[model samples]
Target: MNYQYNNFYEILEKNAKNLKNKPAYFLNNRKISWERVKKKVDTFARALEIIGVKKGDLVPVLVGNSIEFIVAILAIQKLSAVAVPVNTFLKEEEITFILNDTEAEILIASSKFKNNLKNIRNNTNIKKIIWEGEVENIDENNISFSEILSNFESHEVKELPKRNDLAVIIYTSGTTGKPKGAMLTYKNFFSNIYGINELIKLTNKDRFIAYLPMFHSFTLTVNILLPMFYGSPVVIIRSIMPFSKIIKETLLKRVTIFTGVPDVYSALSRAKLPFYFHWFNKIRFFVSGAAPLAGEVLERFSKKFKRAKLLEGYGLSECSPVVAVNRAELQKPSSVGPAIPGVEVKIVNDELIEVPKGVAGEIIVKGDNVMKGYYKREDATQQTIINGWLLTGDIGKIDEDGYIYILDRKKDLIISKGVNIYPREIEEICLKFPGIKECAVIGKKENNDEIPVAFIELEDNAEFNEIEFKKYLKKHLANYKIPKAFYVIDELPKNATGKVLKRKLRENIEEYMK
Candidate 1:
């Protein structure tokens, strides 16, 4: 369990030397070897240096999950620069805010997002715009991906970054306000890589499917960092659309480890597979994170796949994102499992006192994997991390056996007549309905009182009876905890990371009032 590598670069170098001809990345029917990836990283690092990107400089990357995006980030790490990955689904205003807030010297983006960047060029401090694909009307400042690789010569970089040096700045999904960048150092990522490595026990022979958004911490660590650290091959698929393609790739490549959000698993569970769909049998297991995975979804997925085990985990952007996960051997479907190695987690009451076992309280963590602080937001950072513990803002309970059960987000709690109601509890019950595809529970204000409301999306050709649903809920929950009203919707508003934006649902409460 001793990790000999000091930094991410060292991990890559070690993997390249040991697994030279192995396929490091599989994308678009092309296999990129570890040796070639190392060479491309070196060449891109030289190109970045030629363009005046020095150590500690921030380089904001706006790209999808592709080989070029991987190369760009590895190149930035080679030069000890911080890679600020912007969510691809952000509005122009939000993207502009991140670029300005980070003061990024260079913006490396795919050509698909050029329109979003074109409008904000004059407003930010970006000196160079490097496009990963083809583009028209290119100028000196706006350069293409091929041009950089062809123009710059590959050279060895001697200046290595320290473990404490800042590596990347991940912006929170910002369900409430403007997104704040979580500053993660090399040590943070390295510690998490090791911690997760011990849990999953991945090897060079393992193949992973890289379908989640790379900007998010869960995808970055599990799909990218873990595979590279263990010299495993990753199959990169840019789009999750036409999910048949995902199934095809997973089967064809024999993907062993699949990491995804709860929504992805829910969809896969509902997808109708052919009788010959024996491809998933090769998959070792599936990991669910980003949002809470409903027990119903896990049960359905396990029944459908038959051979695949769906494990739930918990994390946030601030903790280099892998706080705890369930192990395959000692699986607990209800718990996200104990804290990973090298990390300490505890449940604290309102006054920050450690709560007794089996009592719900705020979950806080202290470890090397915790982020340094929020970028340029000292007040918010202070509020999030107090007394050297990163306050997770999540409500959960730890059992005497050390299994952690997440109850709900502290902010998502609803108070009705001095009684506390957790929205997750209602949503979990709503999911048990036969026709319910997706659902969200929020508190709506009515005449100075808060009332629980349920918004649901039904499956195709599925029937909905409000009375029957209420009758079903009465058996599982107290009358005060049941939703006062239920509104049928097509879909819930989600952020780039696939988390439901409850704030948006709260804003449109009038639409659901009827």
Candidate 2:
């Protein structure tokens, strides 16, 4: 795909000139225009440069889903510095590991996570902490973000980042070992913007909604960056809880492009709404990412929202996170449509040889959206990206029509009763059960054999009955594929983006089993 701009800063500059006073962002009742956005970003960039930040410097951002998050990141980009966005939900240890691994000198974090920053100064190379929310007083190290926005003057960024320069370092979830930082360049992000826009259609006249965590690649590229690149105003919803707020904002703000995970779609599909919301809401397209869209959820969503299409997409952090999605006009039942324009997808065997279309193998992707490399881990980087194709470590297959079906994670496979069982297949079926809010299946040892066990979270008014659940499972799954046991928990462990963290469940399975 041909990159449109040299970097994000260039795009922001162009939007300032052409879009003028159009809203760049909306938070609650506040509207920030592109003109104001450019000014704030420039001033923040100057503030960053004043505090000893230089080109190629890595600045870790720990802000939440607010306008300040966008401003802080772009401001870092304006000075040609790399912005390392860390998950604010992480504990002190996880956050420290990333800060130390990146060797970032400056840290930008929201004050909501202030308790996590108690000894952050002594733990990492952090020399300054630019706090984004309410702080009683600003110390030498703890600088008030409000002060910068109000006191600093906007200055021209003499050296803007190029397409090849490193733009961000997104850390993997580190399910197995230490999290590896995927280094993404400006061109990588631009390629994703170019590739996705070709499949999913939207324009500057539309408004995009972003409630997912910004640290996730899907939210960063699709929700945050894509709309900005297209010159559309983005509605920044800080949290997804009390989901009614999202629905109200959608109606009030006239949001046309909605992006979320499977849980959000499932809730929206099952949620009974007043006819007025259905008749007047301007939701033209609903995009699902970060996890697979359950078929049952899609079917219910289609029946519920006839005017909009829930285009399910697949992506990972290493590929600038968006590889493919169902087109707005056409969609397959369970497949993540075809690869976006300019991307190549193939099912390959263990040796990286292409397999038959219908055969399940490793899914590898080749495109400009692929990351530059994993930071400071040449061995891991080489293993991930081979011959310009990223080995997704996901077991899936390409259909004859080019639609892709993700069967399961390679490591999450279960061999039960001498047959291979994919947990997602069971989990997807379980999600169809009434009163089941979320379901997660994992392989556990039973005697000498490995069996599939389920951990579920039920709806508020729903109770789990073993006989009823087993009956529900037996209807859709083979005896061997059905979970050997069911455990009802308050909630399923999830990452910031709402993807089920099976590794965590597997690690702590014994505690729940007893």
Candidate 3:
């Protein structure tokens, strides 16, 4: 498909005109057509204008995965304003840091997070607060979303943003430190949407499940933008509570494409589907991203579903969130498949020289999907994107067939006794233990030497014998690669995207060891 349009407004207008009454979103058992979405977005854009939002302004959106969240972002884009999506899971301090850092003038938050916003309202640059749902205490600056839509007239922006203009500033998950905003332009999103469409082959008849948070780049592109671009309807679940209900809804809605993290797939793998309901047969395929999908989890899910294949994908927030994905025709469970169209990926050494096919090195990407830069952080932008290629901190290798295999994050590598050790390898082996539910391997500094430490989370009513597990590891790993200590914990710290927080594990190693 040739992408004739540049900005998001053009796409929405075209889809609304072409697909008209076709459902664009499925929220709370209600189907919102493309025409309705366009109308709502237009009214919201006018409301934003009345509230003093203008071109180039940053509007921080702190909402969940609901229809309002989708409409708010589209409205911001229509007005040519930058949407800074804040993770709803963030604390007041973290949200405040992003708001003050971006100097966001407008904040659009859901009712559930009103208190969080109220806690830091006085410390932010926000002049207007648009509340999506009802709140107990409302202030002068707090405007109701329903009131805005009812009061404002449906209108278009006088001038739409150019393709190169900034559209969204997606803040990183900040597992290590303060999150940095990645500036994505209108062109970046369009190019990525086109590239992904070429690979996924989504159609208007397809229905996706939008359970992941929209703040993450992965969900924004795949779940939200992709469906809107194709004029496909998305089943937007406000919450993932009562997992069985979500499954029943998927089956009832006949959701075609499901995108989720490893944890979700793991849970689904263990779920006992009703004998009468063969709901999974309606799903065309399942996609795993955000975190590494275990082979064991994939095998179990594939066996259980029996209809859809769970394809593992790899990407980062900087690359419009999708760099490589497994094509159904040429699927490889171990590899993340080849780079998607319009993206160039190559493995390079420490000196940035291209490495051999089988050798592991830093993965660098050169593509239109790459972010403009880290907002207001020139040093970080320079360090990340050199020349035209973005230096992805992930360590990976490409096979002779062009498939990419991720080893581990470069920063997560353990250097013990001058020998480099990948924690992923250790963790992968540890997960094979029958009782182990989840595990993370990290390096502990001990007398100027890095000691490999393993943190294990056991399944319910499961027990772990350290000596037996260590003996099992000896068969598959070398003596030096084995973890020096094993600590069982109730749960491992994770970010919103479900990626294990290794940095947190390292910080709290003392408590875990005790």
Candidate 4:
């Protein structure tokens, strides 16, 4: 990829000069200009430096979505320190684990998460804590965010960070086990920014939305960084609860591009929206990522909003969270489209041999967008990246036309008596049933025999009859492929990015069966 800027600071400085008065972002009624952001970033970096932050220092940030969150990360990069953004949804134990593991000395957190840090000072190595909101119970370790911003004058860094320098360490959502931190350089991020922009046409004129959790890689790359790379303004929503606030912002701010998960689209597909909202909105693209989009959700959403294209995308944290997405020029149903420009994606078998087109196998990617490796896990780094190809633990197949179709996660694959069963195939068929709104299939061990069992989430006030559902499935699938049992639920457990928590299902299967 032909990246224009060497690092994030380069882009920020350029935007400060080229688009000085332009609004960098919009939060509710407040508009922050690029010039103002640049001043705050430099001042914050100066204060951090005075506090002993140096090159290669890891600073943990537990802040939520706010102007402080953005400026703090820029300041960390400005001082050539690695920014470790922890998920705000994680518990105190999980949060402490990351801070202790990184050996961080400073933590930038929001006031809302103070309850989680009530006992944190005794547990971790964090010496200084910077809070974004009101400071009531101030101590020696606590510092106000506003005070830090005004304490120091705008200062330049002694040394600028290189493109290869580690910029961020993103902790994966620990569904299977302990969260692993993925080390990403500035180049790994810039590669995806340029690659995705090449496929989806975007300019400085377009306005985007940042409602998803910024700690997630999908939100950080596609929502936050991409807009900054283009000098486009973003509408920042604090939380997804009462998402009608997001709708109000979209219409009022004239947002042109939106990114969401499958659940958001499914809810929108069935919303009783007025015709005027559709006629007046300027939305050009509706992109889905983080998890696979159900065929039912995709179809209903496209039919509801014909003017906007609903493009399904696929990616993971290891690949800078953007491997491929469908473009406006061409789109195939249920496909994530082709790999982005300058990135090569292929399928391989168990022996690491290339698989033929239309054959399902492990998906591996090779590009500048691939991350450096898991932080402090050399064995894992070697196991994941072989021969320069990042072995994505995902199973998929590529068509002759280069469109990619993700089958399922390799770890989620179910084996029953020498037979392989992909849960997505069964879940897709289950979603087509009238009352079902969401579905998940997982392997259940019963008396040494493994069988596929399904969990179904139904629509509002909908009733389900197992006999009819079984008869319907028998027509579409063979006997061995059918789920042995079905459990109805009000809603499936989901992460911040709307990915179904299949691991949670596996853990609770016994209790539900009782």
Candidate 5:
């Protein structure tokens, strides 16, 4: 199939040519122009090539959101190398596993995570490590990302990879087992931007704030890639905490585009410093995704920021992330709006047959944005991408006007504060503890919100300390991954197939709550 331009480097080049002297990024109280960006990207690509990083090789980027992150990603693509972005919050073991699993030969990690990388460097096959911050005594095996650009020289652009070639490997949290890497091609990403651009009209003048972690699909495609494609100036915000800071930056910098999860909106709605500082309404719009946005939160935000519309949407890592979003003018509450252009959505039954409109069934999507497949997992990919439809394990239905409404998560994954937490992954971690014999993890509703709960059976005549257990968990997992409460049980409920019946666990919680 003949495709539109697939190489994202080429997209940046085209945009840079048009807006050469225009401001592209505001970083550390400095403005970078598009022309300067183009030259830096080319120089960084040459630097990567000189360091023995080859085309199609997986290079893990663990840097924070900055112009450097943008440059590294574009530089890797310029050299036909695939970019593997890792979450900075990952534990050492998790980081090591990702590097090994992706076969990442070159690692570009931030200074904050350099110590963790140093501890695991001897255990992995990573050929080289480039720290984002300055480091001394690093031999030929280790280099500083700054040093690469210090004596950088501009070079001719290399031949770009085809659109179908793999460009990114975004690992989604695996509910049933290990996290699987979803291979997204250049075509997949551009198609997503194409679909989104057709629906949400963003211009070069729009100034978007990068709030979500760049490792995830939501921020990667929407916040970073989309803005760059249109040559929009972006303000990068590394932290999403202390809500006041985010609001202050949005108001002070005059950011037009705001995208975050429900937690961020909920916090903003409840922010009560003073009425005189209601200047957040200056933003053109706000977008929420990665979880269901409560209608109450939306209403409160609308009332607080009367002029700006709060838009909610849906998608997954496998779809190059965005499937549908609500239009500001034609609004709907509690609905994920319609499927973006070039994407097809369907509610299907067990036999893959489409269900009638308004009936609840699994939501399926087919489009250029659909991922190639789970890397090296053909069986899993086949099961997911059947008959050209990427079955999003989300239960929902569409109304007569094509508005998609998400009812429940078809997969047993818990999304707390926009981060995906898989039951199996948590259960595995709990089982590794000394006393735990068997475990089942489930999401229980608290104040109409979802939180992770774990039921565990102890060993024969075993004793456990909840306080110490909590500390142990904090050491191994992220704050959100740890369970809110742990219940001690004699045995876990399971079916004939040996699958833990998480439904029963949730039901037990309901009965107990009642």
Candidate 6:
């Protein structure tokens, strides 16, 4: 914990020398500035150090959401290497099993994922492929990330990297299965943008849309390194399901920060267009974390956008993700604000101890954005970073003004007759029902015990009525939080950065209990 920020390419070369000519990013009608994003991140960090790609070498990229994924992740951290991004929607045997499990050798990509990695280029060992635009046959040892940034020359400035090495690996969606590699560092991504810029302030005339998924650590630290650590601008947007062009690129690019999830605010509260389908209040704060939004999607965007606020935060992916955030003088509609400055939140018990205020346990944390573990799996990083806290398999509590709340996932609770439950409190009473749009719940079993089970999704031209959706979830649930069964689905199985794949909805309830 000695970080006085040791080089993330010297904080993007000091925000490209103090926001030189400002505008930092606005892809797809191109804006770019911070001095042409620091001369294309120093000519792609001298074309990734003339292909030897040094310091911790991982590279990978596989782009989509361009500015060549921000000049290949600040030119793989200006040659300290380690980026690893991928997930240009995976699959080519999960992108050659993460370029043969992160032994990656510089594969940068985006000419449509280099034409889908040219059909698994003879099963990738990777050794240099670059490719961002004109994709032709690529066989002759592939190269063309704008011709390796026009054959690099940029020179000098090198030696910086070690804030505990490894910069980014990410991967998640393992859901108790395969995908591992979390790693992170550069002091877990610059102490999570200096601990969420000590609670969100952001600058360079703000902006922010970034339709989540720069291989998501909530858009790699809230819309990419917290809006490139305040030289802000962002925009990006490469599909988070076309909500009418993400509401025409957040109200014709006036976008002053949007950051969604919880199905992009229940698909813009069931969009029909002409903007405000209840609260897009022309940006400036909409937030909502990677999942859980329903309090009827924040009461229909506060009864149709009464000048937007929606906020609700919480974290995971081992906390470079942001721990608690609800902001605006700590507003707590379902909590999650409070613990940001140098982060500490407690809860414990199972002998780790803490517990008191509003009881529920296991949330832990201790900050400078917690992570640096899980990559080479040290027994799954000693069952998740013990001595300095980080447990967070989440089950929360805190309130008494320190906010927090959360309560479900400690492996998504629900014990049934032995009591517990919390399927996000019956998927927030089956998302207050009129056409339900998205839900999950999951507990199921029965004769052998357990119970709950929901899996919904509805709303595209509605009509599932199911006894008025269980009498509008019995007027906001509590018959053990309702849902003994629902199962609708036109979609609901996310996770590539869209959350809700509750283990594929509990393997579709073990194939409907076989």
Choose the strongest candidate by TM-score: 4
lDDT values for all models: 0.87, 0.90, 0.87, 0.91, 0.80, 0.75
Off by over 4 Å in 6: 1-40, 47-49, 52-59, 62-85, 88-123, 128-204, 209-211, 216-255, 263-299, 309-430, 434-493, 499-510
Q: What tens-digit string does per-residue lDDT give for candidate 5 at 222-339?
A: 8888898788988787767656777677777778899887667866776685664564445888998776676666777888888788889888889988999998778787798998
Ranking by lDDT: 4, 2, 1, 3, 5, 6
lDDT of 3 by residue, 1-514 (tens): 3557768888889889999998888887799988988888999999898888888899999999888898899899888889988899988888999999999878998888876776665898788789988865566687899888787899766788888899999998887788899999877887778888787788988999988888889999989888878888899888777677678778888889989999999888877778756643488889999998877787788788776777888888888888898888887766888998999999999999999999989999988889999999999999999988999899999998899988889999889999989888888888878989999999999999998989999999999899999889999999999999999899999999789999999888888767
Clashes in each model (backbone N, CA, C under 3 Å)?
0, 0, 0, 0, 0, 5
Higher-lDDT candidate of 5 and 6: 5
**Model 5 misplacement above 4 A:** 1-4, 273-281, 413-514
**Cα lDDT of model 6 by residue, 1-514, tens digit:** 4556675567667887887877877777878787777787788787677667887788878787767787788777767778877777766787788788886766877776554666565786776687888867665357777766666767655486777777788777677577877777777667667766666677767788887777777877778677776777888878766557766777777887787787777666655556453344356688888765667677776676667677888887777777778887557677768777778888888778897898898888987678877777789888888897878787878878788888777887878888887888777766665666677887876787788878788777887867767777777776776777777767877776567768767866766445
**lDDT tens readout by residue for model 4, 346-465:** 999999899999999999999998999999999999999998999999999999999999989998998898888999999999999999989999999878878999999999999999
Question: Which candidate do you rate higher for lDDT, 1 or 2?
Answer: 2
TM-score of candidate 4 on Cα atoms, chains taken together: 0.98
Score every model by TM-score: 0.97, 0.97, 0.97, 0.98, 0.80, 0.33
Residue pairs with colliding backbones in model 6 are 185-188, 278-304, 278-305, 279-305, 446-449
TM-score of 5: 0.80
Model 1 agreement with the true structure over 131-199: per-residue lDDT tens digits? 988877788788888887887789988888887889999999889888999999988988888888777
Off by over 4 Å in 3: 136-140
In lDDT terms, which candidate is top? Answer: 4
Q: What C-alpha lDDT, on a 0 to 100 scale, does residue 92 get in candidate 1?
A: 81
